[model samples]
Target: MAWSHYREMIVWQKAMDLTDEVYHLARSLPKEELYALSDQMRRAAVSIPSNIAEGYGRQTDREFRQFLSVARGSVFEVETQLEICIRQNYLSVPDAKTALALCDEVGRMLTTLSRH
Candidate 1:
């Protein structure tokens, strides 16, 4: 399919889903972490889709690929934060597991999309 908008991209869609999951996970954290780990994780999660959309708005594939790289970095950042949450006992292993799985899926989608 010829995607005319960023929303049409499967990576962006998956990123959106990841973002939602991250937000849900963040809400379960302690209020003391509102400005720390929770906020950082939320920002990283949001960056994936935001960068994808921004890159899609660029005129060249090169620019889009650059943005995809940024999005990929955010995916790793989210993954790392999720790990921290697990280690800190802020998030359960099962909850972190689900978020981590989404991260992997979004990362794979970003890799596939960037290749094009």
Candidate 2:
């Protein structure tokens, strides 16, 4: 339970990768989506790792678990938003596979971490 740094945690690292992937996908969206879907996706993607680091800083397992719960919610938010993009034809499933996979991995990691 004693992590030297949030960056040292695989879940946190994977979340960061997911955030980066989301940003890349957001950039490919149409210009009109810049302030709408793009902005929202970026925010949700950021929330994942931000909550992880914030909770890690709390230095208590209980508080950290609570933060993980929040991060997991963000994961769902990103998944929903990504699916919307696909449904709207803004992105292809092929283009989103990496981000979606990252989301799933991060979500599962949060679940396991929260249980601790």
Candidate 3:
């Protein structure tokens, strides 16, 4: 189906869900990480959907593809940070699993969206 708005795009919707999951996971981190890992995770999480929305608003497919690339990068960033959180003992294995699953879903969606 044709997407008339960024909100209508499944990629964007999944990105938003990933962001929320990341945020929830971040809330369990140590307060000492407020300006470090936690902040980085939040920013990367927000970037995914933000870039998708921005790209959708742009005038051309090339520009949209560029933005999707940026969004994809942010997805990686979030995934990396989640791994770091697990390794650092900042987040539990189960929590990390949930967030990582969402990240994987968003990454797949972004990949498919960017190709077309």
Over 19-90, each residue of candidate 2 has an lDDT whose tens digit, in order, gives 999999999999999999999999999999999999999967899899999999999999999999999999
Clashing pairs in 3: none
Q: Please say which candidate is ahead in TM-score: 2 or 3.
A: 2
- Candidate 1 lDDT for residue 33: 96
The TM-score that candidate 1 achieves is 0.95
Between 2 and 3, whose lDDT is larger? 2
Better of 1 and 3 by TM-score: 3
lDDT of 3 by residue, 1-116 (tens): 27877798888888888888988888889999999999999999999999999999999999999999999999999999999998998887887887899889988888998898
Give the winner by lDDT. Answer: 2
The digit string of per-residue lDDT tens for model 1 on 10-100 reads 8899899999999999999999999999999999999999999999899899998999999999999999999999999998889888789
- Cα error, residue 92 of model 2, in Å, equals 0.3
Candidates in order, TM-scores: namely: 0.95, 0.97, 0.96
**Of 1 and 3, the candidate ranking higher by lDDT:** 1
Root mean square deviation (Cα) for candidate 3: 1.1
Residue range with the least summed lDDT across 10 consecutive positions in model 2 = 1-10
